[model samples]
Target chain A: MLCVVNTSAEELRRIALQHFARIGFAGASLNAIAEEAGLSKSSVLYHYSSKEALLAAAVEPAVDRLAEVIEGFTRTGRGAMDDEFVQRFVDLLLSHRLEVHVFINQGQSLADIPAIQRANALIQRLGDAVTDHIPTVRDRIRFGVALGGAAYVLVAAAQWSSEPLDDLDETRAALVDTITTLLADLPVSSAATA
Target chain B: MLCVVNTSAEELRRIALQHFARIGFAGASLNAIAEEAGLSKSSVLYHYSSKEALLAAAVEPAVDRLAEVIEGFTRTGRGAMDDEFVQRFVDLLLSHRLEVHVFINQGQSLADIPAIQRANALIQRLGDAVTDHIPTVRDRIRFGVALGGAAYVLVAAAQWSSEPLDDLDETRAALVDTITTLLADLPVSSAATA
Candidate 1:
């Protein structure tokens, strides 16, 4: 077959992700995104209605991808909500820190848009599914708390990361460790003992 | 002592924080802030140098105060860093989740300002001084990561507290548990032990 370089949607998406990362959602006008994507603005608009719609399409898949990562933990065993899974969840969350930031910051601004809302709703359902998989009643509650803690570690990681802790790698490793330990030592055991 | 129900400074700050919280830094207008604060537009300028300056003054204290709270842990346990001190550190951080939200959300918008820079430098110095007291080298390295994780928990706690986590009290308890556990199980403990 004769060569072709720009017709596929895959190439267009890759171009969009790079531009979006460099210029932020609001700053990256659709004109720029279309130019970067090697497609006519009309062609871009033909597939996605507006700049908001394009931004939503570009990022929401990553959200679904993360939710897919979390959903994998559901098969992690009877204590699907156990310490190991929770800790793994923390790693997954922090590893995708920039993506999480994109979602939290720009996602809300476009949240009322139908596609974005549906994507986030799917993310929520994944969380609920994870919680539902845990067998122990009290452990379920503790897991929920641990889940909350994991989310915090993510958002706060940047500011405190600059502190005099080890280098970035070591610091991230420590963060993961801290969350795992927290899950293992959840007060559930003590509550059961009491 | 005489007490006043409303003062110009207090009113302006209240208005500024609300507006900053609602629309973010680039989006909030000084005139809007003045209107919300119930002061003459000139009065806001009289109290603060510029819009960015006013925003910094309003937000930096919350960050400074957060650092002070974490710094309080040094005062506990024979004036040294210890497990009890870490627990109290977690408590201090979790207690002020909203302030954490304001600081993190507005931080980037105000990132380049002198006041915000000074405040962050102070917080970093405070963190360094605390880490200086630790005997175990690995523990010191991991401390920042652990702390970063704790900060993230506060942000996540705020989001969840809006609905599923219910009121702040329950959220606080949940956060305390998560952080305490994370501190206890730091991964570098293995290195510290070995």
Candidate 2:
């Protein structure tokens, strides 16, 4: 008898992430993912017990990376945290757009999953780290807006723009500067600077 | 022969919006909406040709109100545009949370619908209107962040908060102030004023 391993679990996860992002957690099917991975359904099930397991594996890396980013910020001092954090957070999110897409698409359905829960906690911590420096009620709200805007823009950039986001660095720099301004206590005049 | 018209189309739409927001577009069935509205499925179909039509009818008011808000802002001068625009926009969104929920949940699936397309164009126009005064790329992106943040916070507040959003007015005031801060061009120091 000849034995053959159809597809590795890692490859399944990679393909699953793409499917999840393109469709959604409920929309993505194990058979389609197996076919995309060039593996039989039985072989795919052998690696992961169910679709939920596959989703957990697929989203784990992105969640871990985000947790790491938050952890890295926590180790650093309060000064320049917002600048450094925004730069790193934007970079991470832009590079991992697919991951972010999949995670968001899952929405509330997969909220109870360990990976999703962990990511949420980490994100809450991350939000605190960002908003902690801003003393005023308004600035804190603005901080939330800054974070949401960055995420929304990075994710929806393709839909919003006719062409590729060529000015990514400029966008990142602008996002960092904007967040920094939001973090500050005083409001400056545009006419005064001009 | 007896004729009965138990539920109004407007009431059906109100209930439909709630269902669509709670579940989703595909997840929301006409039968379910009919049941919720205490109308027969045939009656629901009589009022609206299909589920898509019903969904469109439900979201149209919010979209139209948004259009009016943007138009109102255009008539005003540049100086008060940001403040007035943010105030009206925030108020509109906070009140019409269900409409926003249904629109967001549908995502790309209903993008091609005329109502959806019109809403998208109006939103694009809205973005342009808000960002028109900000000359730089960064501020423009910040403008987007402010808008996205406001939408996200309002929608996700129920899930993220343990209690009701009782401090909504304070939050609204803060968001307006934050956008005003982002709209400003100069980097005002935190210590300069204090």
Candidate 3:
């Protein structure tokens, strides 16, 4: 029903992300990736020339998904700002904080690798997209800070596993509520909300 | 003159931490440490017999400083539960963010080594001390989240050498304000008035 690249390329990317996340980039070898994907080594090489290339491709879905979520929040022409979408985004990040840890932790220097550097743009765009939708300077600041703060707390909890952060989730919810209230109060247009 | 630690053991510890931070624990060479410290290889050996011993000593100061800071805040007793102390603690971390980064960055795994791992208990004691000072659950929760968020951001910012966080001091202040506001509202007794 779909194109060939759509199916196999997507499948390979998924497999590669899973394996690299668990074992780390250096620990992840071509053979291991191939085995994880149930493919021959040669087949992987056919798709991506090097480990760097494979790693770059693997993060694409995550980048795209985040971009979509952020962009959906900021789509002012079509919709005012969707609190539900924002909540889901925050929830996704909190519940699967490990995915983010695996993404950033494995090596922040991945930006030096030519193909892998694109995620930087994706991250910036996500921030910009959300920041753009908010009308008031205070609201914009609140939105960015809340998002960043929540994300950071989740990572800290993961890193300081022994330290309890049951309260952090409550703080996170309160932060989101604050942002939502700020957005709702903004004197945007009727059509955008309607 | 100040009573500096003249013992061979203390001197070696001081010198090794400098080298380990500049290079990394794995990357630091024992011979180079001896050269910089103005001690012969034999003397360095007399103080710390192995490279691992030297490296463990190297990461200790930053971690020790962190414990010290945590302890200082905790020792303030019920005063630390106040918004002003929380704000000051946040300020302290931001001002010294760079030193914290050097200790935590690659040096975190130093905790795996038996000698340095004991230092983790000191750090945990500090965290425990934080809760012991708080009078209520809500203030305790607020303290944890704010401190956690501030620590995470300030450390990561050290990686970006070009950022003008050097001038505005915005990053640290922003974190403190976030924590202060969250705590102020969450608890009945405590108020974080920025």
Candidate 4:
């Protein structure tokens, strides 16, 4: 019985995540999520107390993982541009593509939500970790482009494409490679120096 | 008299854009906009027939500029990776930073709005223009990362920073340089090949 109840809650979370990701949190309907999960509205509420609660449940894991990634950066102080760090970051992003989508795109508008606030705070910490070692404004922006760019592209690919990214492995490897390249200490451009 | 009317309309657009960029279209209220502009709601309506119309007016110039940029790409078939093209693209993003923020972040939620639909379509055309020459998914994602990444960073910088980006010239130069480097045909990684 406990196992069945857990499964139902898990199923509701999956359905809710898809809805939250496709539509903004403000736009997604709790009733619709309940209906999609083949449960009554009250039952949905039983599992997650409020719409915000459901949102918190759906996005919390991703937020926690991101926090962990940031913690790793804090510990090492050298992992921001490391290959393993980039790979881990890319994998985390791909794994939580939908949650990351919500965090990136809707974060500002949904700032009042506690889950989103925590997620946003973690993102600020992550930015600091990545940019702390970088000296110049140009270089900091480069890392910003690389990290924020990777997040946006993955979210966009998921949103824009009619089909699932069939070449997931290829896309993942490419993302890691591209981000690492952008973060690498390449020669300063003449235009930038000028 | 004509100049005064035009200025009032222009002022409304400017105020409306800041609100829309900050809170989002659905969240921004016409009454508040009118209050900010020291005009009545009816007077605000006189300038724009509806909220959607106001949104249309606010975003149309940026859309037209992007359309022209894509047209340039289509015309030359060789401008996507060009330095001049990248510069123009970066400038468009910075000059209309708020509008780009709305278009990038709130676009999915506001897709029912005609203005947003038009903007989203133009983005698709722009994506096609940039990626048409690239064969591999990796290369295509690279272009996505560079272009989409740049857009995301600029929008984020504007939103996150308490003060305006003081070194606009340096930031712009770095963006152009980084994007050009990403779009340039560099050697592929072994991981990408595998």
- Highest DockQ model number: 4
lDDT (10s digit) by residue, model 1, range A117-154: 66556556654664555444334445544444445444
Error of 4 at B20 (Å): 3.0
Q: Ten residues in a row with the worst lDDT in model 2 chain B?
A: B185-194
Clashing pairs in 1: A152-B152, A152-B153, A153-B152, A153-B153, A178-B182, A182-B181
Worst 10 residues of 3 chain A by lDDT: A185-194
Residue A40 C-alpha lDDT in model 3: 90
TM-score of predicted structure 2:
0.75
Q: Per-residue error at B94 for model 4, in Å?
A: 0.3
Candidate 3 per-residue lDDT over residues B28-140, each given as its tens digit: 56777788778788888776768876765655555565666567656765455566666666766665554444334332445567545655565566556655555555444
Q: What is candidate 4's CA lDDT for residue B29? A: 85
Candidate 4 per-residue C-alpha lDDT over A43-153 given as tens digits, one digit per residue, 9 for 90 to 100 = 999999899899989999999998887777667655334666677889899899889878777787788889889999988877665555666877888888888899888
TM-score of chain B of each: 0.62, 0.77, 0.55, 0.87
DockQ result, candidate 3: 0.17
Model 2, residue pairs in steric clash: A149-B145
Per-residue lDDT tens digits for candidate 1, residues B1-194, read: 15464377767876786665544555567887887777678989998878877777676666666656555644442243445455555565555444455555445445587766665665566555645655554455345445555565455434433553444465555545443444443442322212
Docking quality class, candidate 4: medium
Give the per-residue lDDT digits (tens) of candidate 4, residues B114-191. Answer: 878888888887667655656688888888888889998887877666664788999998898788778767332212
Order the candidates by DockQ, highest first — what do you get? 4, 2, 1, 3
lDDT of 2 by residue, B1-194 (tens): 14364447878999898767654665567888889889899999999998879888889889888888877866653544445666788888778877875555455556878887777777776666655656667766776776676776666564455653678888878766666666555232122112
lDDT of 1: 0.54
Single out the weakest 10-residue window by summed lDDT for candidate 1 chain B: B185-194
